[model samples]
Target: MVQESFEFVVYMIHACATKWNRLPSFVYRKLAESGCIQKFLVPNYEILHTQSTDFVVSDIEEYLNVRKVAI
Candidate 1:
């Protein structure tokens, strides 16, 4: 991944962790297992990175929800 996208991934992982009251590692694992990192976040980085953190988090939540992934 490029530097910005990599950084964005890390930021999102931590953001999700905080919002979900989980550890960053756990969030990363959840996102990875659900393909959120690869299929959603990174692929949509150009647009997502421009949004508010809460907005992005909401988007992630929706994505996970549709996939039946609990936080």
Candidate 2:
């Protein structure tokens, strides 16, 4: 990943962790297992990284919800 995308991934991981009241590692695992990191976030980084953090977090939550992924 490019530097910016890498940073965004890290930021999103922490953001999700905080919003979900989970640890960063747990957030990372959930995202990875659900393919959110690779299939969603990173692929959409150009546009997504430009949005507000809450917006992105909401998007992530929606993605997981649609997939019926817990956490």
Candidate 3:
């Protein structure tokens, strides 16, 4: 039962992020806690084996839009 519940929560996170097309920072934390998103993300191309293809969207405050907590 516990495993089933955890799977459901992960699915919800992907659904909300992919279906809705946007997610808040706090939501991302919950998703990570539920094993939904990456536990550790490398922002730069410092990892030689992997290629960084992510495009960051930052506003005037110079913060990743996805990392901003909605209050």
The lDDT of each candidate is 0.94, 0.95, 0.37
Please give the lDDT score at residue 14 for candidate 1.
96
Better of 1 and 3 by lDDT: 1
* Candidate 1 lDDT tens digits, 1-71: 78999999999999989988999999999899999999998899999999999999999999999999988
Tell how far residue 54 is off in model 3, in angstroms: 28
Which runs in model 2 stand beyond 4 Å of their true positions? none
Instruction: Give lDDT for model 1.
Output: 0.94
Candidate 1 segments exceeding 4 Å error: none
What global local distance difference test value does model 2 have? 0.95
| Candidate 3, poorest ten consecutive residues by summed lDDT | 52-61
TM-score of each: 0.97, 0.96, 0.33
Q: Which candidate is the best by lDDT?
A: 2
What is candidate 3's lDDT per residue for 1-71, written digit by digit as tens? 24544454344444445543666455566545543233222222134114322222212112323555331
Each prediction's number of clashing residue pairs: 0, 0, 0
* Model 3 TM-score, 2 decimals: 0.33
